[model samples]
Target chain A: MEDVEAQTHLIGDSGEDPIISKIALAEVQRAIDSLPQEQREVLALVCGEDLTYREAAEVLNVPIGTVMSRLARARRRLVEMTAAA
Target chain B: MSELHLTDEILMAFADGELDQPVAAAVARVMAQDPAVARKIVEFQQSRRLTRSVFANNLAPDVPSELRAAISAKIEAYEAAVEGGEGKQAKETKSIWGGGMSPVRMALAASLAAVAVSAAYFIGQHSQSEVGRLAQLEHPRVLQELSRLESGRDAELPFGRLRVISTYRLPDNSLCREFRLQSTSTSTDAVACRTDGWRVTFALSDPAKGAEYVPSSGGDLLESYLDNLGAGNPLEGEAEAKALSETAR
Candidate 1:
């Protein structure tokens, strides 16, 4: 019975307007959390900070190309994870 | 060049406007001719938008160092509390979050697939295997069928055979399917709703082992759960198909 109530509560949440937005945000965060730490860090620096590849490389103390490749992989993985979910 | 293979890095760089003008122009020309290439660019752009939207608040000083510092500070504080004592653990921490979250905590704050997680906790409280039965109902095979299985049809799932009884909406208009699962040992009558996924909202197993659940038509657990659910009319034909398609996600 309690389980039924909890399930009802979750289902009720699914119908509200934030269902899509909040659920998508959750999906994205979960996807990001599953990324490799290096990929996650690179993603944070690039997308979260709006940093250019070169600037991000300078901050991370890596070559500019490393930033590009990592960001590419991270972006691709995000697409795959979100779509699969 | 007449043709250039576009790698993800090249497309991403093009999307970010980080490529040289000549290269960017070339990529644009190619994208104009190739829908696949253009779609990749859009995806890269969308991925950037999504990451920024969710992660912007988590980054302090808009740097990776802030995340690293927060993680380390939390770990050190936890360790100090374990070793030195609670008194010294209250010392000033460098995390911009004050008491920063662990990665697990961060993800928890974002979202948890609560059904499965809580099922584990409920296992201890509930006698003998009820939660296990509930958790087992979440198999992809079950959901795949739930999204398409109609009343006249039956599905042979990995764990059991399934028969969908009806399709309807809850008070809040969440799509739901009532189904019965008959394994070799026991039969389950359950209501599944499309939320984050097709989750079983409530279930009652028959004590009649190896027999399909016997319906009383009244005063049963299944009936009781539905009593106040404010169920809408049972969907059928195109409507049922449309509702199930939404649950496919």
Candidate 2:
């Protein structure tokens, strides 16, 4: 029952009030903590620090494609998690 | 319409300001009316703001001398390694190639399809010189996803910058802990295990931006740990604040 509710919460579409926003942020952070090392690092470079994808690629010293692919997977996972949470 | 099929990646890019002007404007139009898309955008924006706000305080203090000294030592070592002779040029060339055949050339190499796919692709790789284990611990799938789109807090987190910046404990009383993670380029979630369950605290701060985290003693970590620990209700206000201040400082 709790799991089902949690699943429903993940896909919720309500606008976030400040109180809800705080909970969502906490959930997001928790989601981030769960990612693969490389994926987490890339997410941080692009999302956390406000770097251009190109700049992030340069920083990580990996191919831009790798960055993109990893990011895609990472984002997909987040969306799923968000939907679930 | 098939032509208007926008992926979540593009929507996220638009939210993150990774879109070029024209592309961003195009997505903005779609988002204005699409409630689902709009919510995702709002979530992204809010998360970004909170991350910035949380870590912004760490920048207030001067770079601890210890951190600066350590980075300097590494830099000098790097210089010495390069100056040490014949092997230097090879290493430099390798780093450049490793950095990827130059971004300018790569951009020019792209086809139209590739250009269209730009926002969805484009992740930054780790530097070859980075040492230590790329330790990505296990987490619930939902939290795992958030790690991807979110980067570290600051600009250029210098290397080897760790300090026992704060501590926190949970009301559940499973555990209390303090950590000294690096101020730059390090994002980790730590959980001090409790008997009823584990009370975890995660930090995502970048020294480059001078971001300092506001201790979330009973915030997400306590609840999360409890969830994982398979016991009890979450912590609230006074206890939460007390646990955070007690452990983080």
Candidate 3:
């Protein structure tokens, strides 16, 4: 039940900000509420599982390099966003 | 670091532990020598951790057992149709999932299909390049073999080799097997029970110790799990064959 949302609807990519600022769940959830409906829908299917870059690309229907690039960009963005918080 | 000239993509992939053995090894050497490079890798790991933590926090209170059941039923139906042959395809595929479905239902259905595709992809990958490596129990041939393989003898398949060390019948009469999966880089000892499928109940990865039977190290863990299952004695010869034959049915 703890990860029911993570399990059922992987409907990310609706532009929702999956924030994890150190402040609190309330604030972090507020950020998630602000994200687009599809951001969360965009393939978070591979989370918690060990997927190769090629595997992740196939899951997302993106190129392998595109997978790496998004991973790079998303990780950096997460760092900056949390740092600023 | 400058000489290695590692790209962000490479670094990110390495941080994700997705790089192949050789490339990931190279990245590790560089990280060991350079603090800045190491920090960059750590940053990527931290970001991933944070994201997962947020997901853990926001999980819905109730398990979506209904959704899981629907998705599983759809998959079973699809597999049944595929196995039943080509003539009845349109009939079974349409009624189960293809009516006037809502947009949300459509997305859920699509995502569920994607998960199945991911499994197919694992098997597809195994068939082409994994004969010597025991990565996953995804191949049907492997499952079929598990159903009949006797203890002591092992089978070498294109996907990998599997050895059934022993078989057991629980107090409730369910059949279970203790087996090992061997590859070039590692070997895994596991226990799987007969159900709708061979469900893995326990697994432990061991360092690559060649294909030859390494005598038990005496500190085995799976032995105890079997002990708890009330497995009295391992079946052998006619008894073993009978147990396995019955399970395959």
DockQ of every candidate structure: 0.19, 0.06, 0.19
- Give the lDDT of residue B90 in candidate 2: 17
Candidates, ranked, lDDT: 1, 3, 2
Q: In candidate 1, residue A71 scores what lDDT? A: 89
Say which candidate scores most in lDDT.
1
lDDT of 2 by residue, B158-228 (tens): 33322222223333354333233342445433333323322222222221121112123323432332333
Fnat, model by model in order, equals 0.41, 0.09, 0.27
Instruction: Give a tens-digit lDDT track for model 3, residues B114-158.
Output: 211111222222232332233365357667877878898899976
Q: CA lDDT of each candidate?
A: 0.58, 0.38, 0.48
Candidate that scores best on TM-score: 1
Docking class of 3: incorrect
lDDT of 3 at B102: 15
lDDT of model number 3 = 0.48
lDDT of 1 by residue, A1-85 (tens): 1111222122112123444455555667778877887788778766764555765676677899899998899889878876665
